[model samples]
Target: MAIDPRGTDLKRLLSEDQGGPVVMLNLLRFDDGGREMYDQYAEALSTTFLPRYGGEVIYAGEGSTALVAEAGQEWDAVLLVRYPSRSAFSSMVADPEYQQVTGLRTKALTEAVLQVTTPWE
Candidate 1:
């Protein structure tokens, strides 16, 4: 039921940083009528905040039939977003303007998984 990251979560995320670019994998489950609200948030994020923080969406799409998964494990959507670094991601979340619109994202999701990824050589 936790939609957004907390200060402790951010701290832990940053503490695990390896000082390199990071791609975040977002698995999202929307509440009823939540996708529309998330769409609005995504627009603002993609247009304003992402560019400002040197971040970009690598991929985003609605979730499809699961080829292999446990019951109740399917997501509504998935997003892959890249940031210059973990710190950059943290900064964007900390931005005052970003904070203004953060509620939209929080309200839109019933569940979410935000995980950081590193590239393989």
Candidate 2:
């Protein structure tokens, strides 16, 4: 049910960094009217914060029929975001300007999974 990462989460993310880019997998379950709010946050992220922090949205899409998950496990949306490094992502989230718009994201989701992925060697 956590919509955003906490300070400890960010610290752990950095401490576990293996070096190089990191791709985050986001699974979102929205509240009523949440999609619109999330869109606003996404716009600011793509237009400003992402570029400023060397990150990019690798893929983003609404969830479709789940062929392999449990009945209650389907997410409303999914996003794959790639950051140059763990520190870059941490920095972006800590930016004051980004903090201003982050509330939109917080208000938009009822539950979320923000998982970090490392590419296979």
Candidate 3:
């Protein structure tokens, strides 16, 4: 049910920084008619904020046929976003301009998960 990160969550995310690029795993589930709004958000994000902050969408796809998962674990879509570093991601989220457009994402999702992943050694 949590769509956005709270202050505490942000603090924890930064604290866990491993001092390198980070790939964020986004598991998204949309409410009724939410996908369209999310698409608007994605358009703005990809064109504006991402380039400004050294972030990029590595992959994005609609979820289908979960081979294995708990009853409530299926997602509607998944996104993999890479940031130059944790600080860059933090900065992007903190930007006032980006904040203005965040509502699109907020309004689009019923539930979401944003997890940071480190590259495999």
Candidate 4:
């Protein structure tokens, strides 16, 4: 239900940092007409914010048939975004320009999961 990270969430993310890059796994469930809005946000992110913050979209795709999930667990879309570090990601989200377009993302999703992943050693 939470579309955006809260201040506490960002603080925790920073406090838990082990250093190095972080990949964010985003599972999205959209509202009606939400895809279009999300696309707009994505465009700005890919073209501007991501580059500014040393991040990139590793993978992004619509969800397909779920072979191993509960009946109501299928996501509408998924994205893997890699950031140079947790601080980079936190800073991006805090950017004033990014804040202007963040409403699009918030309005677009009914539910989402933004999980952090670190590569195995």
Candidate 5:
């Protein structure tokens, strides 16, 4: 997800998790559950990024939403990715090989938001 160019501080999100260099990525929502399409998107991501940059898909899938966020709109999936470093995470998104699959990812979503944060302990 694209960071908030207007307000986000990339450096802040870079230091949240303690176990290693972490990026607390929160995917807010999706248009619907396009399982078949999503699967294809997932495969492309795992194949390209994981093998080279090296990170784990720490979490995924939806859960309850609090009675906040305007109206409790729940997530379609939540992905927590722990890359080797902030630079590595940023680099993955820009790689020519990974860029080829960007369309796959965008096709499965209607609305999505992601924030890379260092995550406060």
Candidate 6:
């Protein structure tokens, strides 16, 4: 859905300017967790974290079904949030409401990768 389908457009946008903090989260499982995992993140991010910081919940939910990989596979659910800054995200995670959801999410997923990346300057 771009001039290039290989994230070239995204990388180009990053190259030009990707101000502030962007976090990419990958939720993975062995086909066992059911719908609870997705539910928890949605609830927590929507009800708890997003409102607290005045930040943007850029993206969320299960990955695209259009593309499937040959070797392995994409994550079960993905989250892309843009916090005001790195510290805002850190503080939000430590906040009481967000902290409470950690237990729910912990029980929901078998594996996950929370990656924080600064866009290219």
Q: What is candidate 2's CA lDDT for residue 120?
A: 98
lDDT of 6 by residue, 16-119 (tens): 44357665544454237645665866677777687787557677666667365764556666767777665565556657877666666666665666555666
Q: If scored against the real structure, what TM-score would every candidate get?
A: 0.97, 0.98, 0.97, 0.98, 0.69, 0.65
Candidate 5, 61-83: lDDT as tens digits: 77575556655466667788777
Residue pairs whose backbone atoms clash in candidate 3: none
Off by over 4 Å in 3: none
- For each candidate, the alpha-carbon lDDT, in order, equals 0.95, 0.97, 0.94, 0.98, 0.64, 0.59
Clashing pairs in 2: none
What tens-digit string does per-residue lDDT give for candidate 2 at 47-66? 99999999999999999999
- Candidate number achieving the greatest lDDT relative to the actual structure: 4
Clashes of 4: 0
Give RMSD to native, each candidate.
Answer: 0.7, 0.6, 0.8, 0.5, 4.4, 9.3
Q: Which lDDT tens digits does candidate 4 get at residues 42-100?
A: 99999999999999999999999999998889999999999999999999999999999
Q: Rank the candidates by TM-score, best first.
A: 4, 2, 1, 3, 5, 6
lDDT of 3 by residue, 23-119 (tens): 9999999999999999999999999999999999999999999889999899999999999999899999999999999999999999999999999
lDDT of 1 at 81: 100
User: Of 4 and 6, which scores higher on TM-score?
Assistant: 4
Model 5, position 109: C-alpha lDDT score: 71
Clashes of each: 0, 0, 0, 0, 4, 0
Give the lDDT ranking, best first.
4, 2, 1, 3, 5, 6
Worst 10 residues of 4 by lDDT: 1-10
What's the distance in Å from true for residue 72, model 3? 2.3
